[model samples]
Each structure stands twice: as structure tokens, then as C-alpha cells.
Target: MTSNDLGDFLRARRARLRPGDVGLASYGARRVAGLRREEVAVLAGMNSDYYARLEQGRERSPSPQILDSISSALRMDDEAREHLFRLAGTVPEGVRPRPRETVGSALRQLLDGYPNAPAFVLNPATDFLASNALADALFSPFESVDNLARMTFLDPAARSFFTRWERAAEAVVAALRHAAGLDAHYRNLHDLVGSLAGESEEFAALWSSHTVYGKTRDGKELLHPDVGPLSLTFQTFDVRGASGQQLVVYQAEPDSPSAQALALLGSLHATRHQGSATER
Candidate 1:
């Protein structure tokens, strides 16, 4: 499943379509299988023979305009279009992904003062920016490195760390895929998703299904080791326009065990560095 996968994936997706899905009607065809190459070519704005070559894997690359046409002919929604672009290696035009940045002292203090909630910042690539102690304790899977996408796909502990791992995993992948669509030159992101698709069967399964999504401002839950299941309301917002950085805030379920876990996490963050006493 390398870059060559682009041809096969596109071919498979095309073959699965029924005529009705693309606003086409059957005109009494005795066909071998699926939509005829000519039909798809007409809809996709490509030569019939050339479209056949693409489907047969004899031709791999297609121009952006052609791909967009094919996407439209296939009735692909925006999410589907983005996923198609990613597979076809067409980077979205004029997209410059902002570089990573260290959170400011003020932001760090804000996280520090969040006694009952967890807050962290993420770069465009979904890497951790600055996690407060509560965030650290709750999202401990991220402790090793800055990457959230990698952690979701590659980290061994993350599967167990996140409650509803499958859903969480999908969210991470979908968000990353959206970002990838916005910037095809997000080479690092492309590599990360590729690596994960190769390494994790779970990722492979979900990615192949062509699901796409963005981060929302609500409905998050994490199963903390010390605190059990902690549901939280979450929100994300732009923090720096120049950097394209986002501030993500997490709030525990009110009056739940998660609140206690958050308090414990704050204490842990506050004291663990000093080593007066410690508990995990």
C-alpha cells in the first residue's frame, strides 16, 4: 500500500458506484460488471481509452482538473473530494501550512490556572503544543512525543488510554486528512498517514472506508487510568492567525469522577516536578 495504492483505491471506489449515484440511468446494457469505462470517461471528462488505462492501473497520474471532474462525476462530496486528492497526490493549491510554535508564557499560565479542566494547544498537524498537567495525565499517551496523529495510530498505549478508541481513532485520522487536503505539501502528514495505514489494520480499515471529518466543540470522553471513565466537553479555536495554531480546551463532566481526576491531575502536575511526593 504505497503511493501506487492511489490507482487501485480510486479504481475500486469508481467500480462500486451505481449509475443512480452519479445521476445516470441505465440504457439497457449487457455489461461485464460495474459502470462502463466510456460512461465514466464521459462523466469524468477524460478520454474513454485513457480512463480505461487509469482503471486498469496502466496509467497512474491524472491532472488536477481531470481528477476534480472525475470526483464530480462520481458524486463525491467535499470530504470525498479531499480524500481523492490526497490519494492522487494532488496537493491543494496555495496552501502553506504554518510551522509549529511553542506556547506563550501567558498560554502556559492559562493552562496552569485551569484547575478543573484540561487544556492543550496543537499545531496544524495535530501535534501537541503545550499540555497542562491535567492534560498530560489524561492524555498520557502523548507524553513521549508531540504528534497526536502518530500517537493515535502508532502508539501502543493509546488504544488502551483512550476510551472509545475506535471513535477517537477515526476523529484523529479524519482531522488529519482534512488538514492534508488543505495542504498537500504537508509532506509530514502524508508520511504519517501512510505509515499508519501500513502499520495498523484498524487505521487501514477506517481509511479505506473513505470517511472524513473535522474537529468539533463537543462530545469527548477519555478513560483515565487513575480516574476511570472521564467524559468531557471540548472546544478548539484559532489562537494565532499567523501560525495557524489552535487552542483546545477539555472540561470534565460536571461533578463526576472526572472532576476529581482533573483535580488530582493538577496536583500531580504542580508537585511531580518538584518530587515532594508522587502518584501515577
Candidate 2:
């Protein structure tokens, strides 16, 4: 909740980023491991001292323009940039906002329509209980699991579900922090994250660095027991009736082997379930 947390995040991220990541030429014999403060300032088109001051919390409010520049310099995507604004105590500028965030009907219907691909609707806090049959099949690890933060941090099986467990875990932690900014009073979410942090060292390290980000349009490689490997792309879209809810749609690339694999999983699941039902 304090500015120190935010400052710590900025410093940590800067230190970890490589010069090559942002296209900064290494002229040889460099002192710092990553880009220096001055180098970042140059890229962001800001004074080094001013950037430092902001990082130190000496300066509080930064304009949208400056944030945009800094976000670009840091190679932040749209999801990451919006997350930055939220982390910096800036609310979405507009008309009236919602008192409580919830997903809408249309998006829910859309999720249901994805018969083969896995999909779900999530709020800012990344709670992903809402999903269709196919999504449930793909994300069976969290099916009927109301709390995503819990599944991510608490569940031992979660580590085996995702190919990039570390990256996924960090993203969830960062997302929770971002949500906390928008809804700091979310006691339930706060409690869940706290409990997970207590148990998992991986989560604890990520929590120390306050990285905030929204959902990015990316592919996830999931190894289904029946399907073997399913390559899926997740895309987020605005929910018309939901204020903070974003529709997360997942699909396999058309005509790809992964798509066939997904179909096989679906067919196998249906047959198995139906057979059990007949026996009962």
C-alpha cells in the first residue's frame, strides 16, 4: 500500500531488464548489469534525477504523457501499461464507474460457444470461476474452483498444469497487486494472496516485486493427459455490460495439430462422461 512497494518494483524491474531486451546497444565495458538510470531516462525522454525522484516517491502524480513514455521505454504492452496506471494510483478516467465488478451475459455466452477451445471470464482480481464446458475441460485444474489466486499459489497441481509455471505464477501475482490497487478493500482477495505468500517461496519473491499487468494476448502450451499438447491463444475483449470484467477467449490455431489434439480431448471427455452417465 505504501510508495516504497512501488519504488522497490521499479528498481527491481530496471535492474533485471537486459540492454538487449530494449534494443539498447552495449558499447562494451559497461558497469551496471542492466540499463542504468541515466540510460532509462534517455530512452523515456526524461531527466534522470526527475525519474529517480518519482521512483523515490518524492514526486507523486505523473501525467498520462509521461507514463506513456515510460511505459514505451520499458517495453510495456497495452495490458501492462494499463496495469501501470492502476499501480500508480490512477483511476480509469471517464464517467461513472462501477461499485462492484462482475462479468456480463454476452461474454458468458461467448465463452459457452467455444465448444473446443478453453475460455473464461475474469475480473480484475483474476478470479476465474466462470467458464464453459470446453474451458472447464482445458482448465480442469481450476474447474469449479472459484478462486484463481488460490489455484495458482496454493495448489500443488497448478505447477504441473502450465508449461511456464514460473512465468504464470508471476503474472498472477502481478495481476493481483494490480487489482488491489483498484480495489484495495478486497479483503477476501487480500487474505488469499497473503496465505499463498506465506506458503510458497516462489510467490513470496514475486510479491516483493510489485509488477502489475492485465491479460496479454498470448499462446499457452498446455499438456492435457488425453490430448498430449494443446497450443492455445488467449485473447481478451471488452465486456459490454461488465465494468471491470474482461472476456478471456482461448482458441487453438486453425488447421494446426494442436486444434486436432483439442478435438480429440473433447471427444474423449464427452464419451467418457456419457459412458459413466449410462452406467449410473
Candidate 3:
């Protein structure tokens, strides 16, 4: 969120490339890692001074054509190329507003209709806006299932809950990075990143790496307290009316052990809810 974020990102990414990586032969003794600023400029078909200024915060804006050239010079993928444009303030026109935090009642109802699947409504910051009973049961291991990023990094149980903790942590950080790129002024996301970075060293390191990725679909392995192990795949759908809200639903492979475990977990949750209602 600093004025130098663009410069910092450029520096970080520049350090990731080597002369050989870009088909440039080593000519002399190199002082630092990756391609030099001049090399990048040459590759991008621009003056070295101009590219250097862009990386030094002296240049605030660059043309979309220049950004596209730089993107190719860096060999960036779709996600990284998009992030570069955002940093250069060359965002495409017709960009939608930031997604809302509230989940619609109809969406909540839809989540509940998935009795077997675990579904939740989430914002870009990974806040659990709403969830179905099965989803609640799925995440019941944590003391509070508030935000996915917070739970993954701050909670002691996360290491045990996610079978592949490292992957989970990286994915969470990348998603947050992507979200941060979308809206730098989003206060909740700003606060969450600050808190996580201050408390968690891993989070700080990953955030500094400038990795950006958005979640679409992914498979997850979880170690539920009651069910032992569960393998599930989740799909995230952007809410039609809400710009930032996402409906995430997790489902297990049919007839698999994970499917059976999910079913049993659902039954247990239902039984407990009924018992609580009866007691009341």
C-alpha cells in the first residue's frame, strides 16, 4: 500500500529472471542475480533510463503498450501480467466495484440446500460471511472459523487440520495477494494483511514475494477431528449481484471414503442440531 509498491514489485520480479532464462548469453562477470535493468529495458524495447525510472518510483504511470511489452519481456503469465497492469495504473476500463461483504438470503438458502456438500459465502479477504451446517461442521476444528487466512496462519490447529499445510498456506497467501492487487484501499484486507504479517513470519515472507493467484477450483485434503481424513474438491463461483462475494462449495468424489465421511459428518451435525433444539 505504499507509493513504492510498484517499484518494489518490479524489483522483486526482476530478480527472478536470469540471462539464460530469457535466452541472453552471459557476457561478463555479473554483480547481481537475474537480468540487469538495462537488459529488461532492451527486452521491453524501451530506453534503459525509462525502465529504471519506472522501477525507482520516479515514473508513476506507463502506457498500456509499454506494460504489454514489459509483460512479454518478463515472460509473465496471465495472472502476473494482469497484476503488472494494475501496478502501472493501466487497469482496463469498465472495472467493477469492489465486492460487497454481505451475503444475500437467497445465496444462504442455496448453501443450506446442499445438505451433503459444505458451502460458504466468502469475501476477497476470506471472511466467512455465511455458511451451511455441513460447512460449519467441516471447519469445527478451529476455535473460530472466521477468516480462512487467519485460521491458516494464526491458529495452532491449522497445521493439523490441513493435511498439506504448506500448500494451504501458500494458496491462502496467493489469493490474498491477488485480492490486494484488486483493491489496495480495501480497509479490511489492509488490516488483515498487517495483522498477519506482524504475527506470522511465514505470512510476511510470502507476502513479500509478490505472488498473486485467484482461486477457481482446487482439491483439498483435510484432517477432521471426528472423521480423521477427508479429500474434497471445491469450486468457487462469483456471486452475480455481489462484486467481491464468492460462493464456495466443497464436494467429495462419489462412493469414495471421503464421500462416506462427509455424509457421516453431515448426519452428526444434523443430530446435534436436533438435540440442541430439543434441549431448548
Deviation in Å, model 2, residue 92 alpha carbon? 7.4
Q: What TM-score would every model get versus the actual structure?
A: 0.70, 0.74, 0.94
Error of 3 at 42 (Å): 1.8
The local distance difference test score of each candidate is: 0.72, 0.72, 0.89
RMSD list, candidates in order: 4.7, 4.2, 1.7
Regions more than 4 Å wrong, model 1: 1-75, 82-97, 141-145, 268-280
> Which candidate comes out best when scored by lDDT?
3
**Model 1 CA lDDT for position 133:** 72
- Residue-wise C-alpha lDDT for candidate 2, range 111-165, written one tens digit per residue: 7788877778776666774787776667665544666777777776677777787
Could you tell me the TM-score of candidate 1? 0.70
**What is the per-residue lDDT of model 1 for residues 1-280, given as tens digits with 9 covering 90 to 100?**
3445555556656767877877889788646555667888988877999877776667767888888888887777777687677766676455554555677888789777876777888876777878777777667645475788778778777877776778888888767756655565666666777777889898888766545666758677676666567778899877764365778888877777777777876676667666745543
Best by TM-score: 3
User: How does candidate 3 fare on TM-score?
Assistant: 0.94
The list of candidate 2 runs beyond 4 A from truth reads: 1-3, 17-53, 62-84, 90-106, 141-144, 177-189, 275-280
Show the lowest summed lDDT stretch of 10 residues, model 3.
87-96
